[model samples]
Target: MMMTPADLDAFAIGFMLTERLADSTRDVLSVEPFEAEAGWIVRVTLADRCRGRIHDRVRHRTSDTGCGLCGIASLEQLRRPVAHIPPRPRSGARALFSAIAALRDHQPLNGATGAVHAAAACAPDGTIVAAYEDVGRHNALDKLIGATAACGVPGFILVTSRISFEMADKALVASTPMLVGISAPTTLAVDHARAHGLTLVALARADAMLVLNDPWNCFDAVAGEGLEPPTPGL
Candidate 1:
């Protein structure tokens, strides 16, 4: 479509879920462009049963770049609670470190735009299984979550952006055990990770990185001592 974002596949699916645009991925029958007086609008064809749940009349909203979190109209939606954290089922921080090291391979879309964020799932073997890239970091994570919901939770998430509370919320929803990134984290991200039992690995370089959450459960210890993540690079 004329107005489609460069990352349409990911953006469409991600926006649908994160905005409560549809109940599931299948609800979106197709997406195309609609010429309007203001500009082109993307009209999504939803399943007939879901037609009334979400109206087609979209009210214009404004925000700065990277400010896609404004759709939260309800307190419950704004601050969704995570389920209690589960026990860490994997061993060895080596697996996580390897995933962080391999984050570059997951940026197929980012390689094109240099403006997209990515979220990838890595097996303990350190190979990326699935990656979703979007204009928004949280949306990227949500796309990864929606795609991975049935495959069962994996070892961790490799994000191409900094960790934030909303990122933590998406990871928790996917039941992902840990999040590794080439960036640092927000204070809220750290607290949410600890609260929900998800490991937060940040400031990852090729050789080393930091585990910035609850060390007792997150660290394998077998991989050695943990440290706080350094500041993120812009």
Candidate 2:
């Protein structure tokens, strides 16, 4: 299916559920688009039976740029508690940097507009498996989650935007162990990452990177004393 920014909020959730268009979960009943005073609204109707519950209307209220949490009604809807991340093997700093460097080349939309955010899932060896882009960082994250949900999580996620609480929340939802950002994280994002045990790395330039939370040893590598000494060449 073709995905535009307008349909992401509705489509992304459906895409992640392992439900296809032939299945009830992703079956599209109808779609209605209308203009509101704020901007534009797209109401999507999925099939009656969807992933255990019947879904009626899922709304995507967006500006021209496709920002996030636009229609949130209460604070309760904003914060969601997630399970702590489990312990896992760490990736070397070199691998992390390699993933970050490779991420730039995958973002054609960002190169053209210079305004969109891109999210990528990279392996421990620094190969990028999937990448998605959107005007909003949250949207990019959601699309990345939907696209890579079945990949059994990756070594880390490389994002081209500042870390936020919602970003951390989404990572936990997707069972991602670590998140690396090109910008710094917010105070709430740090707290959320710590609470959920999701590693948060930010301020990531080519030369340096910061690790906010590393409960799983996903960022730093400890030097061992058992290194072999170099031999002089004759």
Candidate 3:
């Protein structure tokens, strides 16, 4: 089933704080949905230790399709310091294609709705460890993070949507070493990936992919198969 805004927001707030706030430091009390001028708002109430308070509310405004980092009140909230990610072994083009094929095979939600985005965790060898789908790309990632929080699945993340700054931030928060996208990434996303030592790949297809940043060089294409190299200067 497609995720409701309330469910999406709950996962987002819950997991977003999972790294920043220790489980003993905070707890999500409730998630309520409300109508807003911009879109539907998911109000998350939490018990916070930082403020020594019983109630701290964070509002998440989500569009019908679910955009990340929306309805923020300040620029400071838009940027977060990503943790340094250790390098992982290079994933060959064959492995990437296999993982994408697995993700597509398992995405029943996308097959049914054609409206959801997916986030998957793939092992170093390219096997899909786990996957989640949601109306919003961020929600998909959040759900995947929350689902795998305790499982300690160490692998790269693959998304069926464009790589946005928020997507990069979320993966970094999850301590993911690499992120692959079916579409291109924003400049801010690339910058964050570079600064945080996270490998970012995009425009990945069955035939080829682009390596936006690979500080540890954890990506490899088939020696003579799949996508041809881009011609000079587009």
Candidate 4:
């Protein structure tokens, strides 16, 4: 899940915005180089309304399925502390369908290694805004968030992997509010998405998708008529 410092920026932004952790979705206030264990630490400033949304945070890396869970007996970790989302309008199916299809074309890393996981932010018109790939799915998301923090705002994020708890946590930390995944999401992911005001969509592809938590956002599109929505187990 290792990536260059520059790549991590994009991971953070994509992870946050696509996951609906960031309502502002603005650019980074500033990016100062650091010598911490992680490549760098980013400081993002939000609008007046979103400023107070963040109080304290616990940041850590989630690499595997085991890393993104509760009661793991980790030294210091969260028991899933997240706020609620206000239910923003859902993104249309036509838009999502096109974005996911076109996302692969922009994946430079996957072009080389099909095994790598990718993440991207796309414009409303299906234009690929920013893209990043990493060995691990969570790292790809972290890079997306970092990228969004440095660069301008992105419309949404798309992941090549399944929606998991770590993905939800990273999105919450970034404060963006929309996440789309190629596969299904776990119960923990859905719970966190609802608590943190995130719109989590899973199994989105050619003609189908699911809305595990739509309170923060919905998928409204004329082209979505024939497509069936995914059913959350809970």
Candidate 5:
């Protein structure tokens, strides 16, 4: 995978969880990074129960910065079943917009380079609890998941990229109830999100957002304001 090498530890942990290699941090024994001839390499040691799964589950591949499913061996691997998210309380549209407004402030790397993507874990009120950035959008989300896993999943996840099926899948694996993307979502992403009970929002701005999926009516507007009407049966 191509990514910025800043947060190797978080990236390692997040990749493990999002890829379903490790259930949680408890299954990880250690994360170590070292300089290599080509670049930096992060070595993650998994607990005994998690060790065997790695050999059968993942196939190393050369992935570009944009594609998320570059290494999948077959169509079946791409469509691997994911568990549905647990039911959670409803969320307000206000919180989503709040996070959209605050997302820029948390992206130091993007501010400097104007070339990185960011993923943030937001509180119920849209406060950014933690954020991570990388050249690859998937890597950024993975880092965010790794950084926040110990503290428990946040109320939502915010990304500065389009919502692909892989993005939705990662959010679901992390058990975040909502995912807000600054750009649009692919058709498959919307379908997967709706099927798995994830609240998917895209084209987020300070004033309004497009709600693609709200399985439990979680993104209700207060006083009939804040969000664009969702498509029927999404």
Candidate 6:
């Protein structure tokens, strides 16, 4: 995996959990990082209970920063089962908009470099409780997931990048009910989110957001709200 050299511990923990290499944090014993001639390396020690999940498969090359499903050897590997998200009370549009507005304040790294992506965990009322940033969008979300693992999943997760199948899958793995993306979502992501009961929203701004999937009515719908859709073929 090619990722920014920050929050490696979180990345390790999150990667373990999201990939189902370890069922929970209890399955992880330790995460240690060391300097290498090429770059930093993180060594994750999983408990004996997770021994069965370990594999010897190797990637031919480093994963690109924009793509997460890079090293899979077969189409079946990308079809991992997603856990269904239980239904929750509908989140108000006010809260969603509030979170969108507040997300900018939590992105210190992006503010400094103007190149990093951010992922944030927000409360039901739209207060951001935790946030993480990285050059890779997936890495940012992984860091946020690992950072908040002890507290359980948050009300929702917000990302500063387009929602792809991998991003939606990560949110599903974390059991987050809703995922709000600042940009649009891919069609595969929308289909997967609908199938797994994830409330997927995208094209979000301080004023509006488009609801691509809401199988469980996770977001309160405003009848006849004049929100413009993205351009055709987007």
How does model 4 fare in lDDT?
0.62
**Which residue pairs clash within candidate 6?**
none
Candidate order by lDDT, decreasing, is 5, 6, 3, 1, 2, 4
lDDT of 2 by residue, 107-178 (tens): 988898787888888887778888888777776776776556545465778888888776777777767767
Residues 1-234 of candidate 6 have per-residue lDDT tens digits of 778898899989998877778878988899998889999988998998788766733445677786677876766776777655645624556667888988889988889889999999988778888999999999999998888888855578889999999899999888886888989898889988888888888887877678887776544444323434333333
What overall lDDT, based on C-alpha atoms, would model 3 receive against the true structure?
Answer: 0.69
Which candidate has the highest lDDT of all? 5
Candidate 1 lDDT tens digits, 36-143: 797646667778887665654242454223534454454454465455574464634566667767777778777876878888888866678988876767767766
* Model 5 TM-score, 2 decimals: 0.91
The alpha-carbon deviation from the true structure for residue 180 of candidate 6, after best TM-score superposition, in angstroms, is: 0.5
Best by TM-score: 5
TM-score of 3: 0.75
**Model 3, runs deviating above 4 Å:** 1-14, 18-67, 220-234
Error of 2 at 95 (Å): 1.3
Ranking by TM-score: 5, 6, 3, 2, 1, 4
- The deviation in Å at residue 204 for candidate 2 is 1.0
Question: Residue 217 CA error for candidate 1 (Å)?
Answer: 2.6
- How does each model score on lDDT? 0.65, 0.63, 0.69, 0.62, 0.83, 0.81
The model with the greater lDDT, 4 or 5, is 5
Error of 5 at 48 (Å): 2.2
Off by over 4 Å in 2: 1-11, 14-67, 83-89, 218-234
RMSD of 5: 2.5
Stretches of candidate 4 exceeding 4 Å from the true structure: 1-76, 80-90, 150-154, 220-234
